[model samples]
Target chain A: MNEKAYFSEQIRLYEQNIYGLALSILKNEHDAADVMQDAILKAYSSLHTLRDRRKFKSWILSIVHNTAIEHLRRQKPTIDIDEQYDLAAPEPTVDPETRHTVRAAIEQLSLAHREVIVLYYYENYSTGQIAEILDLPPATVRQQLFRARKALSKHLNKEDFDR
Target chain B: MTTPSDRDIRRQLEAEGRPAVPDFVHQMTEATLAALPEKLPVQRRPSPFKRISAAAACAALLMLGVLPNVSPAYAQAAGRIPLLGSLIRVLTIRNYTYDDGSHLLEADIPHVEDDDNAEAAALINADIDALTNAAVSRFYHELELSGQGYGSIHIDYETVTATDRWFTLQLRVTETAASSTTYLKYYHIDRQTGRHVGFGDLFAPDSFAALEAAIRAEMQAQMDADPQIDYYIEDEQPDGAPTTLSADQPFFFTENGDLVIVYDKYTIAPGSMGNPAFTIPKSVYEPLLK
Candidate 1:
């Protein structure tokens, strides 16, 4: 197969994963779509940088991750601490009627926590791999996971979930 | 209600993450692919035909018994045709990837592919190794001392110019922390000399003062011609840019053999000016060149 065709097929297979990652990081549909396009072009241009084609999945995702971060960085000089939220105290109570599904609970997470969770739980990257992807320390990834779990427990921690 | 298990969370995460992604390849890549140059310089793949041709050439040579028992006459003739002897190329020797939450590094260091020109290739390769290793070790040293810092360096290279007369390999490094900056180191071989020539080797040492003046004049001319263009020329800015051009200043030659002196960002101007380059027309530097 020609290089172009092969590349197109690969993108076809991974487009959903690309969109998912961008959406989780950007948390906005329009912006996520823009990033998906940017990431695709970026991956296509820099394909030579990847020595092994087998590593394409993680490599492309990392490019998407970097592109998304760069987009966010351009929008604002620095991420505001206020927006990151206090993981220590999540919420007082959960309304039974508005019972948070795991998906909905994840949506409530700050960008910092949301990205790691999605990459880990959804994509199954290891803490070490996640560190490389997100440019974080392995230890920090572990700590974030710990805090993220505590924070999610506020919403997922309920009494009648057996059903 | 009870807490969900990791499996349950994974299922829900899947539900949230997977949306039907449209056929974005055509929509996105067509324009990008069209806009890109026919070939990216960093692409190292040799075509199937080239490989076949190389094999055929080897077989032909062996049929003539040139390979099994090469004659001094053939050796001298083959030396003129570089392909018949050996082809030099650039190869990615190693990729150094590391991250510690605060400090990160991703370097794809390349070396001149070994060939009969091992002596010259070795020199270029050694320089590349030293530059790359120093950057990586510097990151680690900072990580060890402070326990926290935010810096990243990405090393990529391209063969900018390759011909029978001259060969240039550019090692482009981008370092990022609070902000990003780019640095370029160029290696060149004047095929006529068969020896790698640096900026100093190209020009007579005593002539640098004149060359520095020439470069400063170009910087000033650019600024004068366009208000948008700026540089940190002496007395133009408070701190003043370097007044003297060092012998080892980073540079590369044009196809026409013009000399372009390069300065990394924040060296000759503010970061906004980017990497400043001044090309000395061959006519201007001809007398100074060796």
Candidate 2:
């Protein structure tokens, strides 16, 4: 396939992965969506630098990680009145009454913990690969993952009494 | 209440990501694809060998003694005493330079002078004229497009290999607009045969496939060895990526008689990989050589 076709295929295949990654970092769906657009376009423009097409998933995710962080940094001190609503936690898709599903548990974790968990579990990236994508030391990623799992277990154990 | 294991957590997360992407994101993806040019712009890569053979400009010439003093009186008297016999010389016959701030052009046109081999000289000269002229014409065309200058094409030549049996001339052309791109063309002549030799000429008709496969293997090996190195091996680029060598593929025989296959900058790899060349030992392809 031509580069454009290949790139289009990859984007479609990984769009959800891209969105999840950005959402985990930004926690604001609108901002995450914007960041996703920025990162994908950035990856497309710089695709020539990637030596191996197989590494494209990780490479693009790394770009998304960096772009989301930058967006977080540039956000204004005072949220716009309309945007403040988006900043609030997104409503849970399932287990509406409990509000303690694994998805909700993941949303409650710190950004650092959330990022590692998504990369490790959702993307199936190795610890070393996660460190590379997040630009964190491997030790930090391991520590964050360890702590995140502990917190998640704790969060999930306090399950729905409504069940 | 039971806590979830890592696998359970992963499954749930995967489930969360499974819903269809938002309509807005699909639109954005479409828009991004639309924004891209129909053809991906091949990034201009710097030639890796450029540092080794810098074409230092010698815009003018002053060679009085070496060349046949083709003075009108001398020409009339002897008719033609074609200089030192069989001596090979390359001199900058003309230098075209124009720089009005934005648009600049530097063309150091060279002539291959071989007194005993005028045929070879004429062949090389004609080809060089065509290349430089095309480059110059494009430079003017682009210049006229914008009232302000866009870029320049600097054409220069370097003799990469010159031996009693073989002579290889490498012409490097660099064109720059918003960015710069550089490509190379090599011309080789077999002194013994009094004829030009190239990728196809040196190989048997049936050897083309083997030669292409060998070059492709080298490309894969290079990328495997160095993660930073990349070739458009199977980028499915209908045009730029090569599954076959050009009839006059840029190549030269080393003094050691090793056959080197060369692709111009941005030919097989991006501009950053520069001009890629692989040297195959003479023995490997000895049977294939004509």
DockQ of predictions, in order shown: 0.11, 0.13
Q: List TM-scores for all candidates, in order.
A: 0.46, 0.48
Q: For residues B1-290, could you state the per-residue lDDT of candidate 2 as single tens digits?
A: 34456667766665555435678877876786666554444331233222221111111112212223212121122112232345776767656666666667777767677766778878887777656655555455455443332367787888877887887888888876433457687877788887766666787668878877778888889778876565666653313345567566778889888888877654565444556898887877788877
Which regions in candidate 1 have their CA more than 4 angstroms from the true location? A78-93, A157-163, B1-4, B11-17, B22-41, B44-172, B175-290
Best by lDDT: 2
* Tens-place lDDT digits, model 1, residues A25-117: 777767787776667655554555455677677767877877777778766757754355334445547786665566667667767777777
Candidate 2: how close is chain B to the reference, as a TM-score? 0.68
Q: Please, what are the lDDT tens digits per residue for candidate 1 over residues B155-268? A: 777776777777888888876643455778888877766787787787777888888899888887877787555565666331233656666678888878788888766566
RMSD of 2: 14.0
Docking level for model 2:
incorrect
